[model samples]
Structures are given as structure tokens and as C-alpha cells.
Target: MLRLGCDVRVTDTDNTDKTPDFLAGHGDQNCHIEATTIDPADNPSAEDRNLEDAVAKIKTLDSSDFQLRLIVEGRISRTLSKNELEDKFGKLLVGNDPDEVRRGIREMGDESAPYAEIRGRNWCLRGELQPISDAQKVEGGSRELLIGPMGSYSGDASREVREGVLKKAKKYDRLDAPLIVAVNVLDIRFDRETENSALFGKEQVRYSPNHPEIPAQLVRKPDGVFIQGGHKPRYTRLAGVIFFDGFVPHNPRGSVCLYVNPFGYNTALPQPLYELPHAKGVDGRLNRVEGVDVGFLLDAKSPFKNSGQP
Candidate 1:
């Protein structure tokens, strides 16, 4: 809001948990803004927990010369015993030549490429050893392992967005003003489609029983965050939702967009918020309005170049 030139103040709810984060005024218009974050999928099975526990133990291995990368697949029916872990991984790491492993690491352009492999009755583990710095070797630390992206699963972004919006809507129900829920989605899969599906409903094709002559018509299911069956609006207090995909203070390059709820009880927004890129529902159709990039408002140097990472 500081970037948008709004005179913002922290909201107080008499020490109540229902308070929103901020109240801001811009050009005679004002609204309550609540910020939230949707993290990656967290529903893990018992097998998943077992695998993670084993990985944590692997990270504690005492190897100074190389950083271990573990590519895991399949189900862990039983816990991997410490002796079995050592036999499969420890012996291999101890006998491997560091120079040979470094050359193998360079030869494989793909980061997922593994230099060694081990298997159990129901699972397979691929290991990649990357040579560490001489300084790191001297100052020994736990043999931390980097997890492969393939091993991590991010669940549906639409479900995540819906749950996030609903949770916030339920929190600040008594606030009488227009409320904007700003969400920072951490999942890489979050996109325009995800946002649309979460707010409007998942698109599907259906045929009306009374109008059999009519061709199959595309329609939205009644499962959106702000919509219910028969295109009825719900969560009317939510004026809009501001979406930021993986946007953090350190990295501001992520796309910023808004979804204005057509059914909101108090849909009015401050002047600065209206200028942002937004999409609105009109007669069940979404109309997207393009606006200035957030970076244009900041007038700052490139976020990537000035990131201070060497």
C-alpha cells in the first residue's frame, strides 16, 4: 500500500482475533486489507512421513567432501533400518573418488541425473554427489542432501486458493467495509486458470434435461469460493482478491493481479486498487482488465540484478 500511495494504518479490533491487517484510504475511498499466504501441499501419508524421516537422517550423515542429492521413488512399506541405510549409502560414499564424482556431475547436464543408485523391496533411491568447497571440507558439517523436485508434489492450486479465501472470509465476518484478501501463492502451479476456477467454479459441459434439443452447454460447477449452485454469490463481504504468484519482499517479479467479486455486498475499492490489473465476473463471463505492472509503481532497479546473491 505504501507503494500505491495509500495512507494506511494498522487496524485494531479491541484486541480481538477478528481484526484485519490494515485499513487504508486513497482518494476518498477506503477498504480493509488482509494478507495471506497459500503454501505448497501438506497432506502427507504415513509413507511420506517415513520417507521424510529417513531423508532427515540421511542429511545428518558425516560426509565433508560432497553434498548429497537424493532422488526417491515408490512407497516405503517399512522403516529403513540404520544398518541398511549405511550399507546402501554410507559405504558407497566412503569408497567413491571425489574427482571422479565431480567429473560425473559435470558430464550430466541435467540436475536430476544421479551418479549412484540403491534399491529396497518397494523403493528406489538415486544419489548424486556434488563436490563441495575445500573450506567446507575443512569445517565439517552434516551431509545435507538436496531433494529432487520430482520427489515433491504440489497439490491443486484451485483447491488451495478456495480454502485460503474461505478461511479468511470466515475470520473477519463482522467488518462492515469492503474487504480485500491479498494472497501470496507459493505453489508454482498457481496461474490465471487456477484463480478463475477457485473464484468462479471449475468449468464443465452439461446438457439441460428440459432442453434436449439444445446442444451441450459449458457451465461452471457450484464450488467456487465466492459462488454456489445456480451461479449464486457467496462470501459477499469479500470485495476482491489480490493474487500474487510466489511474490515475496525479496523477489517482486511475480505477476500481480486482482479478482473483483461481482457479488460482493460492498464492492467499492480505493482509487489506487482499481488501477491494478484485474478480472471481474459479469453475467457469468470473466472480463479481464489489463493495467500497469507493479514494478512500474515502484520505479526500482531490476529485482533479480539487485538481489544481492553472489
Candidate 2:
């Protein structure tokens, strides 16, 4: 907020624990902002749990020239224990020729990649070996198998985002100023659809009332954090919600976006917030305005060059 020319101050609830995180004043536009995060750990799926366990077990194996892109499918194979996995995958890596695996992957991609599998009646764990590039390998050094961070499955991304917003909404009863909840949604599958569903409710198709000729028109269900069922404006104390994914210190370039509440009890949000990339309802239609890049707001540079590699 300091970067946005807002006079920012930490909120004190007069020794009480309940309070918004902070308050920002920008040219007579004062609003209370609460910041929160939606972490992946809080909502783990069965696939994620199994994949995490499989990776944890296999990443401990020794590998000199290869990294494993592990794939876990079906049920958590009761047939293979963690120690059994380490031993079997370890031997598989040690027995395979890294040169042959590399050549095959280069020739046929995943189809040619040498694969190792251990399967039970209902479950399977598989690993495909790829040669470790020189940049990743240390000189004359052997290391634990390098396991790439991938293959994570999404677990109700919209539900997680909704729960995060609901938790913040219920944090304080009624603040004097406009309340803006800033949610840093950290999930693999979080996107515009997830955000729209979580905050504005799910989309549905209905016939236009005024124009009966229109067969279908997209409309959102009122089952949202801001607009609940019964078609009433809920959480009116909330002026807006600011959300983004994959935000970190010194890097706000996820380009913070805002959703203004049409039925907010407080006055409109400050002009500075409008300068952000935002979505707002106008004439019952949601419109997104492209705004300044967050990098310009904070004068922060990307850690990577134009090539997108550090």
C-alpha cells in the first residue's frame, strides 16, 4: 500500500485479538484490509497423499546420472511398502544404463522413456527415468535421486478458494470502514474459473427474461460468499476481494486483481484499487479492466530475464 501512495497502518483492536490486519488511507478512501492464504496442504486429496508418499519414498534412492518422473496411480498399493519401494526402485535405477534411457527418451519422448513399475491387484506405482542435465549434476558427485515436482492432482480448487474467503469474511462482525479481503490463493488448479465460482457462485444457463428469443444466457447462482441463496446481498461489510495466485515476497507480478461487491454496505473502494487489474459487475455483466502491471506499482523487477529462466 505504501507503494500505492496509501497511508498504511497496522490495526489494533484495543488489546482484543479480533481485528482486521491493517488499514489503508488513500486520499480520503479508507478501507480495512485482511490478508489470508489458501494453502494446498489444508485440502489434500487421496491422489496427492499417495503421490507425496511415493515421491518421498523414491526420492531417497541413489542416482548418479538420472532423475525420475514418478507416477502413482490407482489405490495406495498395499503390496508395496515404503522400504520395498526404495529397494526396488533403487535396484531398477542401478541396473539400467543411463545412456540407453537418455537415448530412448530423446527418440520417443515418454513412450521411449525407460519405465519401472510395481503393481498390486488394484494399485500401481511407476517411475520413468530421464538423464540429469549437466547443470543439475555436481562434478564427481553422487546424490539422491532428483525427483521433479510434477504430477500433482487438483483437489477441489474452487472449494478451497471459497472456504478461504468465507473464513476471512466471518473474521470480524462489522468494521466501521470498507473491508477488503486479500486472498493469496496457492493451488495448482486455481484460475479465473475457480475465482469466479468461489466469489460469485457457479455459472448456469437460463433464458433471458426480457428477450425470450435468447435460448440460453449465462447466469451465476446466488450461492456465493458475497451473494448467498435467496438472491440477497450478503457480507455487505465487504467492499471487495483482492485475490491472486503464486504471489511471493518481492514478486507481486501475479498482477493483483479485485472483485468489487455491488451490494457492499460501505462506500466504493478507493481510486487506487480501481487502478489494479479488476473485475466488477456493471449492468449485471462482469467486466474486467486491464490495469498497470504490479511490477510498475512496486518498482520490483522479475528475478528472471526475458527468457523466463533465472
Candidate 3:
């Protein structure tokens, strides 16, 4: 059972009009628990879909009462690009004393400079912060700096930019503390599929396993990868994921066939007997073995009555 802390109740629905397997709390202020379990056969895809649904449900609630916390098992997945990282965190790097740091960087020019005190501690500006004749490089101990012509930067460039910003922010007491980004992987996909495949016949490749390197400090779970934001000094966790199982067909040909059986009475038969000339007996046995699809329960406090809280 999983425990979620929400200030308000949660609700959910599925693509089919069938009542969603949902439970929710009621009151002006209360914690909520949502419990969901699918057949082990539908583990991967179904769990992913459930996580998306749960997150979406939390987002729709009124933001005033309670903060939301999620605990999920299984594999969850998401992709983050450099632009997205910047969009979520760029402003934090703009130091309170921009004018002062800008002057320092400008003074450093193109030289491999030694560290100088920004507030009191030393900082070395390795690259020219101003408009450059060409790409510029700066190195101060373990930190590296680079500046490129406008619009000539990539995502890696932003990481360097943020690092530079953090150094600048350290010099000023008036500025807000550097913002942190946090991520938690509730699950990760271990099964191997095609690693890199082109999407939509476009020349561009999708799902590059070797691209967009992830940091080692982040934790990996059964569902997905989690990433933290900001320079290491001000790192914060930002996201989490829940993994689920996937289903693949045992017989490719049978999976592709679209024909439906005309005998509605035998709809419940297992695959092996469904194709037989006389399958009525098989249908009877199938009915006997089939368990009721007990709906999920959504209580105000606990969702998965089994998985404990994080």
C-alpha cells in the first residue's frame, strides 16, 4: 500500500466509460491514499499509464490545501532536454549582484586567470563574458566556462552557464539562495528493446541510449531515472517515476489478426481453446477460473494498501 499526502481528495477515470478504479478522501483538509494493481501480465504498460493518470489527477486539484507526494513501484519513464532544464531553472542563476560579476568577468578578458575574491572567497573567470570575436574558454580549478556567439549554444552550454551563474551568486548576500532541482526514479525499464530507432521516418533519431548523459549522484529505481537540478552546492530533487510491466505477443500473426469471433457466448474462453471446433466446454472452464475484476479503492489516506510511504 502507498501513502500520499494531499490536502484534498483525488479522482480518476479511464478511456472506457466504466467507472474508474478510484478512491478519494473527503474533508476540508485530509491526506489521500490511492491503491492500484493490475494483472502481472499487464504490468509494464498498464503501470506507466497509471502513473501518468495519477500525476495528472494530482495536478488538477486545487493548489491551496495540500502539497502532493507520490510513492510508486514499477517502471516510470520521461525524457528531459537541456532546454527544459533551463526553462525550469534559468532564472535562479541570475545573481543578485549581476553588475558586479559582469564587471569581474569582463575584466578577466581572454586570459586563463587566477581566482579572485567575489565577496570574500576567490573565483577565477576563465572566459570573457562579453561578446566575443570567437568562442571563448575559461577554467578555474574544477570549473570550466565557455561563451559562444548568440544562438550558437547547445544544452551542455546551458549547464556551464548555470554553473557560472552559481559562482556569481555566491558573491552576493542579497540574492536568493541558488535554486535546486530534484528527481526520484520510482522505477526503470530493464528489459531490452530496440535501443535507438528513427521516429516517423525522419532522419532524426529518437531514444539515443548514449546521448544526454545523466549524473551519477541521482538514484535509479525500477520505474525511471531521477535527476536533481542546480549546481552541486544547491542541488534539489525535482521528479519521480513509477515503473510498470509491458506485454508482448507470443504469436505475432495472432496478434495482428483483427477478426472477432462471432460466437459471443465463448468470448471468455482462453486463447488455446477459443480456436477449437467445439469450445463450449473450454468456455465453461474459463468462466470458472476467471476472477472478478475488483475495482481499485481510493481512500483519503492510503492508495496501495500494501506499499509503504517513501
- Tens-digit lDDT track of model 1 for 152-241: 333347877888888888886747678999998988678888988898888889998999999998877989988888778898989999
Q: Write the per-residue lDDT of candidate 3 for residues 1-310, one digit (tens) a residue.
A: 1122223222335434222222222233221112222232333344345444434533333211112223332233342233432332222232224344445547764242221111112211111222211222242122212222112111111222223223322332321111111111112221111000000011223343676574334222211111122212121111111111221222111110111112221122223221211212244221213211112112322343456754
Write down the worst ten-residue block by lDDT for model 1. 147-156
Candidate 2 overall Cα lDDT vs. reference?
Answer: 0.76
RMSD of each: 6.5, 6.8, 25.6
Across 1-310, the per-residue lDDT of candidate 2 in tens digits comes to 6666689898855746488888988887789899888887877666567667777777667777787777655546343467778767787777888778877878778688777788766556777787887776756566556555444443347777887888888878888889999998877688888888888888889886999887887888987887888878898888889887778765655657888987888856677888888988889888999977876655454334364555
- TM-scores, one per candidate: 0.65, 0.70, 0.14
Question: Whose lDDT is greatest here?
Answer: 2
Off by over 4 Å in 2: 13-16, 41-46, 57-67, 71-110, 116-126, 130-146, 152-156, 203-222, 230-232, 300-310
lDDT of 1 at 296: 54
Question: What local lDDT score does residue 21 receive in model 1, on the 0 to 100 scale?
Answer: 84
Candidate 3's TM-score reads 0.14
As for candidate 2, its clashing pairs are none
